[model samples]
Target: MKVAPAPSKAEVISLGCRLNISESEQIRALLADENNVVVINSCAVTSEAVRQTRQAIRRARRNRPDARLIVTGCAADIEREQLSAMQEVDGLIANTQKLDSRAWNVPASSRPVLAQHTRAFVTVQNGCDHACTFCIIPKGRGSSRSLTISEVLSDVEHHLSQGAAEVVLTGVDVTSWGHDLPGQPSLGQLVHAILERFPELSRLRMSSLDGVEIDTDLFDLFAGEERVMPHLHLSLQSGDDLILKRMKRRHSRKDAVDLVRRLRKYRPDLAIGADIIAGFPTETEDMHAQNKSIITELGIVHGHIFPYSPRPDTPAARMPQVDRAIIKQRAAELRAETQKCRDRWLINLIGTEQQVLAEKDGTGYAPSFARIQLPEGTPAGRILNVKPKKLEKGLLK
Candidate 1:
């Protein structure tokens, strides 16, 4: 006799970026009661990312043969023709329509509930308008868009009510927020509105921002606001001016260094994070050296290093390509540099008191985003004041 299949449930496998993760949460809530549905919210940031997406699709299919496998997100849209041909996928949702109620065939009243997270991710912006030569995200995400101030306030309030101790404002180009809205208000004004409206929000953090786009209001908050966590992650793709120019980046190398220096003057404890690419097209040894040194120059304790991976239809891909081996080596070097800086920073934090928000993974994150190991069985989402006595394998204990 044939056995009956397991009960159907909705599962979203999200790949790439914090914004994708946040969007997946909304999709999860929308399909909470739906039957045998598995959604692969894919990524195509790099050729490797697309390969991983395909791998994820195949693995998901093998594991859940009876489930309805749907694909969405950047990969679904950007790599549309390729992914649609995969036998494992049943359908594809446009990246823009993935969040719409009608696309999911769910009721319009379905409320977004982030029950699994301790800190909520509130997306205030989406998409990018800039056309950096090396980037293909704009094509995948479409033009920039901003949620109105009122909508942002409602999002923040909802997360606060759900016991989220911290709320992160995330987007593809977060600093680009408010540019398309009425009067084209600066992101600073939007940030000010959120802080003013929600007095109960204990911690307000920002995701990656373009250094050049930071407005005066936002700068002042970073400098003076205690509730605003002392961390800034800049989208500084390269440190060599020539490489930056080739990438069509707005800021120069000095501009980033100067911004960090100025911010640190007012908020000495501010930690710097950056996204630095390695082995970009036409990069010389001096250029690679500049990329490595910027880590130290910016005091970048948190570094996201991406070895240059050419995406289809990008200008940089057409330029003289860097050897794959060299790219791999350079990426490793960047990681070592970042690790050295981070280890030293973590060591210095020993004996200092930190306000940590607990997570289910037996660890918590301090406001500086430092990982601190918690005592076993500590409740998730509990804010603990921890004076770490030692550092253990990259974790403060």
Candidate 2:
């Protein structure tokens, strides 16, 4: 019997969602070694996701031809056949189990996340059970599951020791968290545990949630836990009740409207964001206007506007498809409205102090939860006390 030391040269690539990024880290650990190696986390939510995944694969082949190419994530699940056909990939880990985190937290300079980025991601939950008509996540990522409260606390402690100043708790369906567990612990409780255990962390953030996720328990008391990021990414698939029913989404328009009202009522300065899908099948022009008006009324700080992409296996794929022209037209209109809302929020924050994690110097300033910029000399890594005094029209100036 021979004891193999394991492959020293390997890389892992992921495509789509923060959970995928977290999983790719796990894949790295699965193939890690005490030798020269490179690992790349990939994303494929949009064109950006595909580009990054391809770039990562290409970079590895160019730089480390000897390294084994391992591929995984939602993109792999969605396009497994296509990725499988790629000669570049040496091994494939499709929509399998979650990737462990020990793999890819390495530092370019022996420091995780390097000098500029202050916050690192910690996914407390994985998978989604929702059947939103347009989404294929449940097919790719499987069922709703979560790490225990003790497990999450331990990860935070490890990050704090590794010099992370902030942690963003992420998952596919974060609001659906804890339902799988026996006691059904709430996300708020997890937040409390993290803050209680490690007060050294400067900030904490949650991933997007549907309107059904927020209860009075969270919107009311979350502010008291000052470390929690005062931001929420709520989904408003459509503002029309008919579309809501047609799409089989969980809540009505009023539910989403009231959810924002609660967040604002609880924390007046809270930065609220939203995701609006335009041009689903059977979407009328009037229904589109209803969404635009609802968005205007909600006053969302930022909006991730997307036109419907009919995935192969989703229910919506069987329905009559909206013309690409109509979808594009509506998406352009929604995108303009989204930017207006974002601009208003940025301008409103012109002088308010906010905590920002500096991510490298780019066009002008540091970008954070808010599309805010601190002055030129503002340091990148540490949590900075920033009062955004000016808004550069396009990128943060």
Candidate 3:
């Protein structure tokens, strides 16, 4: 069998989440042997994110003076004209176009070099249908769509062939998958299908999920499937009931707490993570306190804390604004609390044996997604059975 040639030197600078990283791999494959081209797959979750994207474009141009630079991703889709106005950018591609091979004039035979060796992120779904008041993602990503079951299985086979130990299903709204497909299958069905088809797949993981949409099959898999990783990152934006309502989020504090509690009952070692926004429009001190308390109450070891930044044209941007100083302060407080939670979890794992997938430079991640530094010269992409002896800095030693 003829092996695909190694990826060429074309640069792909990815910003934002794992979904963008997955798409960047495709961009790299499409533009592989092409000369003097740099692709910036951007993120536009917040205004600060967009600013950083622009800064990256400038840095890329300065470093490679003659390269033809192209910008794509959510930022390009939402603010095409603004990015086009920048002198450094030679072309612009939309979020949808980024995944389509025809947009890059490349054949469909080109396959992505999934990043980090140990794991591959397969984008099973895209876009969001829910209209959360603070979000601009649906406008940037358009309506939700999904890849067919066969298409996803093919990709999984390819990844496993390349020796990926884990495959993480990613999307703009992962739980919203299959709504556009035949029979209106649930995300749970997709998970069950993947596991059934590929019994050899060692580990399967998922990106962020919305608490409200998790179906019965998924919950059962969470409870009984040992192959599925025990960590879950939830899209729990706020913990205050009034703030959640104001943000148009689907779940309340009680709902989130109850879901975590129930999942923990099924798998005692389950590690819960969450995304929280600090100081949304009209948020008060009591509301921020509730957000802080829920981090401890729910035992969320992994926390993605974002200081609320109003995006242009979003409903929250037009609502009564929180003071910038207050937002910064509240975000700091949340970060500090998150550190304490993380530390407590790590300390609890001191003498436990963990199955770790080595990523690079003698470092790997346990099933709970905690980083662990291993013995020297351990090959990347190898899974090892390790007994964590100590906590050094923030990593397991």
Q: Please name the candidate that would achieve the greatest lDDT relative to the true structure.
A: 1
Report, for every candidate in turn, its global Cα lDDT versus the true structure: 0.92, 0.69, 0.90
Model 2 error, position 342 (Å): 1.0
Scored by lDDT, model 2 comes in at 0.69
Q: Each candidate's root-mean-square deviation in Å?
A: 1.5, 5.5, 3.7
lDDT of 2 by residue, 115-183 (tens): 213566788887788787777767667899898998888777766776766677888888777889988
Point out the worst 10-residue segment of candidate 1 by lDDT.
108-117
Model 3 residue-pair collision total = 0
Quote each prediction's TM-score.
0.97, 0.84, 0.96
Query: Can you tell me which runs of candidate 3 are displaced by over 4 Å?
Result: 1-8, 107-116
Span of ten consecutive residues with least summed lDDT in model 3: 108-117
Per-residue alpha-carbon lDDT of candidate 3 for residues 1-397, written as tens digits (9 for 90 to 100): 9998654467999999899988898788777657678899999998889999999999999998888898999999888899999999999988888878777766675565544467989889999999899999888899999999999999899888888889999999999999999899999999999999999987999899998899999988988898889999999999899999999988889989998889989899999899999999999999999999999998889999999999888899999999999999999999899999999999999889999999877899888898898989999888898988999899899
Q: Which candidate is the best by TM-score?
A: 1
Regions of model 2 farther than 4 Å from truth: 1-14, 29-67, 98-117, 362-368, 375-378, 395-397
